[model samples]
Target: MLQVFVFNIPVESGERIGFSTTLLLAITVYMTIVSNRLPDFSYLDISYLSNFLLSDVTSGILLIICVIQSLRFYHAPVMQQFPKVWVPDLIVGNPYGSNINLAENGRVVQFTNEGEAVWQPANVFEMNCVAQIAYYPFDMQNCTFGFLPWGFGVKDLFFNVVSQELMNIYFSPNGKWEITNTRLYSQIFYGDQLLRLEFTFKRRSRYEIINTVGPIIILGMLQVFVFIIPVESGERIGFSTTLLLAITVYMTIVSDRLPDVSYPDISYLSYFLLSDVTSGVLLIVCVIQSLRFYHAPDSQQFPKWVIYITKVCSKWKQKVSPKDKQHINDEQIVNSDDIHVPTASEEEEREAPPINWPMISGCFDKICICCFTCICMIRTIVLFVMLTM
Candidate 1:
């Protein structure tokens, strides 16, 4: 929706420059431009009683989608004290426009003793605002329209905001976007007087988070479960491969749906690629290595690192409770015990048995499960953090 309301276009009353509405009307006649039809015009002028209004501003973000409503130019009485919104060197890149003419009919209101002449033309404006999609699903974009008064400079004319409202009261809510901020400020661009109307839109990212981010994270967690399957069953490799294939297919299907840039850059693109590849491909490699370790012959001796790992796992698993310890001591000291119990301290002090391939493989599986579970969890946490921040 264009912001349809009264605006103040002030002129320097003390200047000797002639401020005539007739000249303004002439330029208004030549200055017919729409978002598409408005061509690049070089000449400028400020006419008498010129009123610029925006109405029916309809916009949708994600890729900065906008529907051009109407850009109406009206004539009003002499300027009064109106509020001004001053901003520094603010710019909104470049927008596409064409040169078109504005057609107007003179309108006048008559009172009992006084009268005001109102001239306006019915103009239909079509503006197409393409979004900058760098941030994608979690992005805020500025859509701005700058109007310059022809044949005028800062020394000759001043532009100010008449109404404080930047948005139309009738604007409908958009499903993918919401207005976060607005600016109705004026500044000089080049040597001309420019009046700018800007709207900032933030993307509604719930859909992307639920659909795109959720699947990648779920796949990452599922990939780690392959380590739980016993290596002897020979299905660990198959399970990991199947998962990898499924993820590849899923990615291919959703490639078009993921918010990305024309050329590859950061934002969600990096996050998706890093998360999926790390969680998916890395686990597949771990499965292959685990199977190799599992199938090694008994003749093969455990490496020093493997021995250290198994020893760590062994001590961790060998904890005893006080009741169990007392029962074991009693049984070890008596011959007629329900069951003969070995001395726990003696077992701990004995020389370790020769390490075998099966023991190493089993230990390796346990280690992979523990490590990858933590990794997948960390990745998921990081993903959430990036989105929230």
Candidate 2:
């Protein structure tokens, strides 16, 4: 038989003491059960059991709790109060032992115990990107994303890039850009240690070449055809003006698609701009040439060189046979039925002119054709060099 003594106590105190006693009893029972299930000491592997309990079971449980909490309260804002817990700050001589993982919103940093913590809950981010466009449709670019602890000094936390392969594997491919290379680096920046990831990408030229460059090249080539139209047809100026306006509209569209950068490395756009200016100047020259040919009086005296060139260009003209000349005279007589025939002195006056205005105009057209052909060839060569480079 057992004798028991009971003491009266406050309700809250008794509850707390009972709860503590119950927890101790439960732990003792668990240990006894685990010990009974174990094999004899001579046959048991203590190292395996110790590892399983400490590293696998305990750490796994804690990791699971961390993941769940992170997901459940990911949007919660964290605040820190003054008089914070002090941590040691130290710089890392080597970063091989650390590990880094990139998250969607930020980076996950794991440091070895060799370094001291300068501060808690710091953030570094990538926000600025500058693009080079000198090559235009076929250009390459390098961009960087970096991070460093905000409040931690170099001594408190060491920053380093653990893996570039992770970034390369996760990078998404796009129609306009192709990833070429990825690199990881670490350096001290403004007294803070910075870990940087750099990505190099090249522009895919197929889309731009097919959609933008092809049409522009065709238009540039067609500009040469404007000079092919006869000056007397009254369409030369109008056609050139229309082509100029079309080019201007296309330029505006291209400009709108590009970023507002001071220097876009694309040579194609500059080529187009230069082509437009050249076309405008060509049009002006054509207008002047046409005016000179049409408005010049038959009595106007041309330079000796001009007369020679005109005569040479007109060599293809068939000499008038006597029979054709007679026919021409008969047609003139019939058209002037009420007019008296010209005297010898008047016929001699007409024959005294050395240069014919109509012949000189025809020669000018031939010269324009040759000049425009040469310009087109030069433009083609330049474009080839630019695109290839």
Judging by TM-score against the true structure, name the best candidate. 1
TM-score of 2: 0.56
Q: What lDDT does each candidate get?
A: 0.57, 0.61
By summed lDDT, the worst window of 10 consecutive residues in model 1 runs over 62-71
Over 1-389, each residue of candidate 2 has an lDDT whose tens digit, in order, gives 00011112233343433433444455456555665677647554564554444443444444445444544443333432333344333322323344222222232333323343223334333345677766677778887766655567788787655565544454467988888887888879889887676778899989888887777777766766776677668787777777777777778777776776775445566665567657667765876675587669977778888877776665434233322433365445454677798898786456444457766776677777677767767776777677678
RMSD of each: 22.1, 16.6
The candidate that wins on lDDT is 2
Score residue 241 of candidate 2 by CA lDDT. 77
* TM per prediction: 0.59, 0.56
